[model samples]
Target: MHKELRVAAYAVCVRDGQMLLARWVARDGGKRWTLPGGGMDHGEDPYDTVVREVEEETGYTVEPVALLGVDSMRRTHPRRLGAPVGFHGLRIVYEAHVTGGELRYETDGSTDMAAWHPLDEVSSLDRVGLVDVGLALWRERPGTGRVTGIPEHPADAGN
Candidate 1:
């Protein structure tokens, strides 16, 4: 079986009883809300990756104040248009605060929209599992830094 590993960084930014989120547009045009962040570039620090990704996806400048937690998962999944492959994802979560810049939508990117949602209403939104995992890290502060039961892919809504 083929094997692949991906590492990404994401941020949780909450202000005034609301959280900032981005609308991730899948390759098939389906959309789901997720935290403001993405994959790390080669040789780049995960902290920098979170800052850069937040800006790229949400049009807001942010400063990651604390390392919230890290989540990892290994699973079997499809690769390209081929058969099953082993995929390991290492995701770093951070608690961030918006420093500057105006709220705007990202054009020509993985996410098309960015907006703040009330924290109380987050449960009703169509969102990726990562959002819940991030919130759990921020709220519960699990010692192991791993969040169990997140779906391998956000597109798998049943998970």
Candidate 2:
């Protein structure tokens, strides 16, 4: 199987009518916005991974406040993973509250800058598709369910 099981987490932090996001160039040379979170190390807790990742990427300490939902979607695409590829990902989304630290870009992470982008402006910036899903889960805090029948690629690309 060419599929890799990837586990990741993300935080939705809203402040002053804006959402704090990590802006970086995705591997495809497309600028994308995402919550400050990433893959978890084996034996590491999802909550801990979000905290560690956010600190590393956005220089903010966050405490996960709610379990948004789990996205068990299979996504396939060319050059998806550093090269033409396919992927199956299980992503854990969470609602996090800022606890400590200042907002700044940390070079150690993939993002070039950490800042609050107004929610109204989200559409103007490039984004990973998951952001909308994350926002949905964040808004509803749906628990323990799978959003099924989702296609593995951009809807327009195929049947």
Candidate 3:
């Protein structure tokens, strides 16, 4: 078995009852809405990662206002050659505010389109569990910087 650890950052940017989201392109050719963030680069701070990722995916210059919470997830799945791989992910979530930039789609990237969606309609969209987790952290602002009760899956996110 192969073991892997990934650290990433995400942002929950909400303004006037609308949340910013990016359309993630899955390996199976499906699309799902997700937060505007991604993995950290080598030697990169998670704070910088969130700012850079949000710009890349959503075409917005954002300032992380507060450290929302962290979500840790683990899973094991078979690789292409049938070898089992154990994956652990640490996601740092932030409450971000958009400062500038225009809405645009990411070209040849993990996400396709960027848009603002009404918060009330988020639950009805085809989305990954991280979306809910980020929202939960944003809404509850848990003291431990953690959230619970959301269903997570390996395929729902990646670095």
Which is the leading candidate under lDDT?
A: 3
**What are the Cα lDDT values of the candidates?**
0.85, 0.72, 0.91
The residue-by-residue lDDT of candidate 2 on 1-159, one tens digit each, is 365678888788887788888876554445567767888899999999989988888989999988778876665666534454456677788888889999888785567777888888876766665666666666566555444433333431111
Candidate 1 residues 11-74, lDDT tens each? 9999999999999887678898999998889999999999999999888999999888997767
Q: State every prediction's TM-score relative to the real structure.
A: 0.91, 0.81, 0.96
User: Which structure is stronger by TM-score: 2 or 3?
Assistant: 3
lDDT of candidate 1 vs native? 0.85
Q: In candidate 3, which residue ranges exceed 4 Å CA deviation?
A: 157-159
Give the range of the ten consecutive residues with the poorest summed lDDT in model 2: 150-159
Which residue pairs in candidate 1 have backbone atoms (N, alpha carbon, C) closer than 3 angstroms, thus clashing?
none
Better of 1 and 3 by TM-score: 3
Candidates 1 and 2: which is better by lDDT?
1
Model 2 Cα displacement at 118 (Å)? 1.8
